[model samples]
Target: MKKFSLLSNRAGALFLAPGAILVALFVIIPFFWVIFVSFTNRTLLGRTAVNPDFVGLQNYLALFNPETFFTRGQFGFSLILTTQFVILSALVGQALLGLLLAWLMQAVPKPLKAFTETCVIAAWILPEVVIGFAWFAFLDYDNGTLNGILRSIGLPGADLLLQQPFWVIVFFNTWRGAAFSMMLFNSAFQSIPPSYFQAADVAGATSFQKFRDIALPLIRGHVVTDLILITMWTFNVFTPFILTHGGPSYRTELLSIYTYRVAFKDFEFGKGAAVGVIIMLINLAFALVYLRIARSRNKEAEQ
Candidate 1:
C-alpha cells in the first residue's frame, strides 16, 4: 500500500510538472521581469537601451513627483478615469444589466429567451477589433446608421463618440462584455433552488425583495467573482484604442493606453514598466479580495 501510494504521488507530480513549468516560464517570469525593468533607465532611443543601467526607484518616484512632466496630472487623470470606467462600465453596467437581463429571460417565452441569449452571446463571441469597428460604424458622426436615422426623423445628427468619448467607450465595453456576466449569473441563478423563490413568493415577498433577500444572498459568491474578474479585465482593456485612440484631448485614455503611449509611443520603457507594475498591484489587491470572498463562501457551503 505504501509503495502504491508513493507511486501515485510521483505520477501526480509528473502530470502537473508541465503546467507548472509553463506558468513559471510564461506568467511568473514575465511578471518579475517587468518589475525588474521598472527600476532601470531603459529607453528605446538611448545608447544604453540594449543594456540599460539600474536607476533604483527613479522610475516610480517620477510617477509621484510633480516636477516630472509625465507625473504632473495626466497619469493621475488616467488612473481616475480608468477607475471610473471599471466601476461604471464593468461593475454597474455589465453586472447589473446582465443580472437584470438574465432575470427577465426567466419570465420570457422560450423562443424569445433563445433569441435574446443568442444575440448577446453573438456580441460576446465576436473579436474585440470587430466589435470595435462595428461600434465605430454605429457611432460614426457623418453618414453613420444612428445619425442617419436621427437625421431622417428630423432631429439633427450628432457626433456622439467625439462629444462623449468616455461614456461612449463605457457603453461600448458594457455592451461587449455584459453577455459574459449574464451567462455567469444565469448559471448561478439556475443552481439556486427554485424552492427558495417559491417560498419567498408565498410569504408575500415583492420581486425586488425576493431579489434583494434571496437572489443576492444566494449568488453573492458569483457576484464577487464576476466583479473582480470583469474589473481587472476592464481596467486593462485597450479597446478604446480602436474607438477613441485616447484622443479628443485624452478624456478616455485609460491606464493601459497610458502605459502603451509611454513605452511604445514615447519609447520610455522604464516609465511604462512602472505604470505596468502599478496596474498589476491594483489587480493584485482586487484578487486578494476575491480570494477572501471565495474562501468565506466555501466555508459557508461546507457548513
Candidate 2:
C-alpha cells in the first residue's frame, strides 16, 4: 500500500507540476497585473513618470463618469444591445445551422460523405485572417462576388455591405463560424449509443421526435459547450470590427471594438482596463453558468 501511494504521488506530480506552473505563469500572473493596472492612472505616453499611482477605486468610479473618455457611459448601453445581437446571432444561428448540417451529413450518400466532410473541415481549417479577407472580397459592394452574380442576372446589385452592417457581420460570422459547431455536433451525434436512436425509430417516432428526444438529450453536453464558446468568441470578435471598421455609424461595434476604441484609441488606460475587466467579469459569469449546466446534466446522465 505504501509503495503504491508513493508511485501514485510521483506520477501525479510528474503531470500536474508543469500544468500548474504554466497556469500560474500565464493566467494568474497576467490577471494580477491587469488588476494592478486597473487601480492605476497609466497613460500610453513615453514620459516615464510613476503615473500609475495606487489610486484605489478611482478607475472603478470612473466607470460611472459621463465625460470620461475610456468609460464612456454610452458604450455601456451600446454593449448591452451589442451583446444581445451577438448572442442571438451566434448561439441561435450556429446551433440551428450546425444541427441541420450534422443531420444532413448523416443522411448523405457514402461516396459524397468524404467530399462534404472535407469541405466542412476545409472551412474550419482556414486561418481566421484568411477567412476575414475572403469574406471582405466576397461582400464588397463594387467588386464583390455577390454583386457580380446579381449583375450577371441583369438585376441591380444592392450595396449589401453598406446597407446592412448588422446583418452583414452576423451573416459573415455565421457563415464562416458555424463549422465549429458543425464538427462538434457531428462528433457528438456520432458517439451516441445506437440503441437510443433505434429505440426511438422503433416507437413510430418521426424525424423530429427522434431528434428532440434522442439526439438533443445525448448531445446536450456538447451543445452547452458550443454555446459557451461561441458566445464568448462572438462577443469578443475584434476581427470583424477591424474589417468593417465598425462602419456605417457603429452598427457592428460589439463589446471588443468598443473597448479597443476606449483603451487604445482614446488612450485611457485605466478606463480601458476597467472596460476590459468588466468584460472579463461578464465572461466569468457565463463560464460559471456553463459549468453549472454541464454539472447538472452530467449528474442526470449518471443517474
Instruction: Identify the leading candidate in terms of lDDT.
Output: 1
Evaluated against the true structure, the overall lDDT of model 1 is: 0.88
lDDT of 1 by residue, 1-303 (tens): 445454587888988999999999999999999999999988998675999999999988878766644442367878888889999999999999999998787669999999999999999999999989988898899868899899999999888878889899999999989999999998888898999999988999988888889888888889889989999889899988899888778878888988998999989998899999999999899889988988998898899
Regions more than 4 Å wrong, model 2: 1-22, 46-50, 53-55, 61-73, 199-204, 297-303
Cα lDDT, all candidates: 0.88, 0.77
Q: How many backbone clashes does candidate 2 have?
A: 0
lDDT at 19, model 1 = 100
Clash list (residue pairs), candidate 1: none
TM-score quality measure for candidate 1: 0.90
Listed in order, each prediction's TM-score against the native is 0.90, 0.83
